[model samples]
Target: MFLSTFFVVFLLGVGQAQPEDRSKGLPTSFPVPHTDDMLFYLQRSRNENTVIYDLNRKADGTVDAGNPINVYYIRFARDGKPWPLKWIERKFAYGYSHKKLKNQSGFQIELVAYDERKIELIPS
Candidate 1:
């Protein structure tokens, strides 16, 4: 009788020690247009100037299946015009979704210089 009781107590203790589900408290929806902001970590390669990272939702702020669309970052020059390049040579920033304009699915991000910012992207 003592052995059986101890075994049951041990099992209960083990169960309690296990970690809780990490996604239980996460948000289900992405940032909304003109009403929300989502930060992202940006990186660049030799061929591409910008790549999106640490985003949980799709560009349209909808649940993504597996493959999400890639949106490149654009920088405007001092002449009040966008840079003309086939691909950005080198660029990196930490930006957040600022607004969702007409015809845009995801929020348009406003990027600044890189920093040690950490963003937790919800997993699909």
Candidate 2:
């Protein structure tokens, strides 16, 4: 009876164990890139690398109609530099398709990897 009770207690303790926090003890000086055209950036708990979304502009200082958002990676793990997505990443991961909204109010952007959630980009 004592052995069975101990086994049950051990199993309960193991089940109640909490997962380690990966963000804990990480470096505080993670690099952040800033640019004039950058709209925003995203970071994940998986790594220090960041995804940047910027305004795609034409030579005449106007936003590109067909592709208004330029997406790329700021690889902090490598050299903390900006890098374009590879072909596979573009087609399967982070690449997005956008369409102009009616009356030119904004755009409806859909991510290639996750098409269920729609993002609206309205120019100010």
Candidate 3:
């Protein structure tokens, strides 16, 4: 009876040890060639930069899926103009169907860059 109870407890402990997330292979977004921002995105949700990383069993625990997208590296063309949020939208078709876009682009992404952490998309 004692051994059976111990085995059950051990199994439960193993399952509980599992983390809530797994890391995906998506690379962190790099700058657009001029700026210093970092970016990473989810291909499944082309327009959405809220890339989620699922729990992945990697050799090192440092890397994982679903890291937040960084947008410091890319630069705007005009001096004052910024990389439009629409750029990510149109690039990934944020509002449009992803399946259609995927067929053409095969899940590529355009990284965005900004100094402030807040996404410019939301209206002030």
Candidate 4:
């Protein structure tokens, strides 16, 4: 009886340790459809010691066709700047379908800065 109880408890502990959604911030595995308009990918470039907000454009000439949407890069030394972009991307990107954004033609966005424990996006 004790052996059976121990086995059941062990299985329960193992199940709790692993989550159903096993995903990470970098290196996305799921293939999401590309958008012709402006699409952004925020990546941590360890070599440059900065974060790269890569704006990728589709084949159409609507967005910046010549370059890789070349929007911007940010170098931050703030106390807690490591994971804000990743957190935003993880929250927004997961299971995000672009069908709703099809009607939107253009986007006007802004980034603001604040001091201490606050994070902001910088353009290169």
Top candidate by lDDT: 2
Model 3: per-residue Cα lDDT over 4-122, one tens digit each = 99999999999889674434543345222323322233333122123321222245643222322332211222343334344565344332111113334222222332222333111
Clashing pairs in 4: none
lDDT of 1 by residue, 52-121 (tens): 3334457677734342223334331122222333333223333332344345444443433433342223
Global lDDT for candidate 4? 0.38
**Deviation from native of the Cα of residue 4 in model 4, angstroms:** 60
Candidate 2 residues 1-124, lDDT tens each? 9999999999999999999887675656656879789977777666778888898989997889899899999989778888998899879988889998998768898889899999888878
Ranking by lDDT: 2, 1, 4, 3
Give the alpha-carbon lDDT of every model: 0.40, 0.86, 0.34, 0.38
What are the per-model numbers of colliding residue pairs? Answer: 1, 0, 26, 0
Candidate with better lDDT, 1 vs 2: 2
Error of 2 at 14 (Å): 14
Q: On a 0 to 1 TM-score scale, where does candidate 3 land against the true structure?
A: 0.18
What TM-score would each prediction reach against the true structure? 0.22, 0.69, 0.18, 0.21
Better of 1 and 4 by lDDT: 1
User: Can you give the lDDT of residue 38 in candidate 2?
Assistant: 92
lDDT digits (tens) for residues 14-83 of candidate 4: 9889565534333333223233333454433222223343444555634442333333324333332323
